[model samples]
Target: MAELTGRIALVTGGGRGIGRSVALSLASAGADVAVTARSPKELDETAAAIRALGRRAEAIVCDVSERTQVDAMVARVKTALGDPLILVNNAGIAASAKLTDTTDEMWDRMLRVNASGAFYCTRAVLPLMLAAKWGRIVNMASVAGRAGAPYIAAYTASKHALLGLTRAVAAEVASRGITVNAVCPGYVDTEMTDASAANIVKRTGRTEEDARKILEGFSPQGRLMTAPEVAAMTTYLCSDVARGINGQGIVLDGGALQS
Candidate 1:
């Protein structure tokens, strides 16, 4: 039998990039999946792909930063496919600016979406996991969470808060059969990275290709990490085999920031 044959998973930001990949990966592992994001079109595509894998799937439109929306999304998932046994907090946004240039609005927005969004979603689904005595929670964090970087203070701070939440919750639930962990990938090949590169081009007058190369150069492997690679790690963490792995931030940056 498949590892997660009877489980249900909820993946936020499931419309595209790593979230979409993780949702599909969980479905492939035999779990029914419900995906949430703001984009109906992308969520529909992701849901369609999961259904093609023969697993039950639901696509929900949600803005995770709002507690009401998060609660509603989880309730909808429960009604559609039972309580989610696995939760992937992948909904996030990023922007780069010098610390002095960063606005109050930008800082607030960063924490609202990247950190608070995960907290709200996790809080909503945690009760079901605790009651069942089994759960896997994976937060899609970033390398910035671990170390400092230039021009991304707000993004970095939000991710650090997320990691803090991961450790605290993992410790809280360690004895309760629930594991919480984070995946911190550096410079992923996603639309988010593309936007970053575009921003670089605009600010530095560098060609798009050169801007991309600059981002890729951050990883020792000289390439951006693929969504499937992150998804594979997330799926493994959600499996029975990974029950012992908890409260960890597994880095995937090709040997960068080893500590």
Candidate 2:
């Protein structure tokens, strides 16, 4: 039997990028999946892809930053796919700006989606996991969570907060058959990174290739990591074999940010 044949997974930001990859990966591993994002079309596409893999799927339109939406999303997941024993908190936004230019709105937005969104979803699902005495939670963090970099102070701080949440929740549930962890990846080859590169081109007057190369250079691998690579790691963490691995941030930046 497949490792997660009886599991139900909920992936936030599952419309595209890493979230979509992780959702599909879990489905491939035999978990019925529920995908949530603000974009209904994208969410529907992702859900259809999961169904094509022969797993049950649900597409939920939700803005994770809002507590009401998060609560409703979880309710819908439970009604549709049973309790989500596996939760991938992958919804997030990224922006780069000098400290002086980072507005209060930007800071609040980062924290709300990247950190509090995870909190609300986790809280909503904890009861089910505790009742079952088995759960897996993977937070899609970044290298910024471990170390600070210039020009992304707000984003960095929000990620750090996420890591803090991961570790604390993991500790709280260590003896309860639930695991909470974070996957800290460097620049991923996604639309988000493309936007970052575009921003660089607009701000620094560099060619798009040069802007992308700058991001790729952050890792020793000299390339942007693929979404599947991150998805593979996330899928493993949600499996039974990974039960012992809890409360840790697994970094996948090709030898960068060693910690």
Candidate 3:
């Protein structure tokens, strides 16, 4: 067991991808985790994985974009399990689109889920964290946030906003024993990247293999980061060893974004 023994953690978007990996990583470190996602079925899988690690899991169904639902989610988490000492605001959405082609719905959806959702979840959790005098918040950002991608205008803006929020909150809560940070990953081997790569293949009329190579070229390592690799950083940030690591946007881009 790692240093997170007995700690309670809540991970939004815990059903799949990096979020699911982060949840399991926390459990492996001896934390009791609450996994939240829009689908109960998916959340159940994450919970089952946690249970397999001999850790308790609170499976929660939540759509972080809705404020009312977010409030209810916080209440429910506290009610069913306990106050979460660590929060991973990993819920997000991205669209590959030009600014001119972006619709109001697309832009708003990106912002609501990627940026505003983090705000709401953080707001809901901060009071309790302050009262208890300890907390760790990790927001998932992307390489698009740091550099201008050709498309994905809305997604880029939203992730940039999320990174800003992460820094601001970390500064505000520094004296409260709370560390707020953002993890910005470059091309990750997740569903989102799969979709992006597929789109590139279609647009360029190139083979999927070639398109994947082009995407992978964005990383200096010429490869995608694994969810478990990113999860390791997240779990570390929540541990006692990372008390001084605050307000930083930790990029997992395989040297794509030097920071």
lDDT of 1 at 184: 96
TM-score per candidate = 0.98, 0.98, 0.97
Q: Candidate 1 on 1-259: residue-level lDDT in tens?
A: 2289999999999999999999999999999999999999999999999999999999999999999999999999999999998999999999999999999999999999999999999999999999999999999999999999999999999999999999999999999999999999998999999999999999999999999999999999999999999999999999999999999999999988797
Scored against the true structure, residue 253 in model 2 reaches a CA lDDT of 95
Candidate number with greatest lDDT: 1
Global local distance difference test of model 3: 0.91
Misplaced by over 4 Å in model 1 are none
Task: Point out where model 2 deviates above 4 Å.
Answer: none
Model 3: per-residue lDDT, tens digit, 1-259?
Answer: 2499878899999999999999999999999999888989989999999999999998988889999998988888888778988999999887787779999999999999999999999999999999999999999998777888777889999999999999899999999999998888888899988988899888899998998898889888999899999999999999888999999989898886786
**Where is model 2 poorest over a 10-residue stretch in terms of lDDT?**
1-10
Q: Which digits, one per residue and each the tens of the lDDT, describe model 2 over residues 72-146?
A: 999999999999999999999999999999999999999999999999999999999999999999999999999
Clashing pairs in 2: none
Greater lDDT among 2 and 3 belongs to 2
Please list all clashing residue pairs in model 1, or write none if there are none: none
* C-alpha lDDT score of every prediction, in listed order: 0.96, 0.95, 0.91
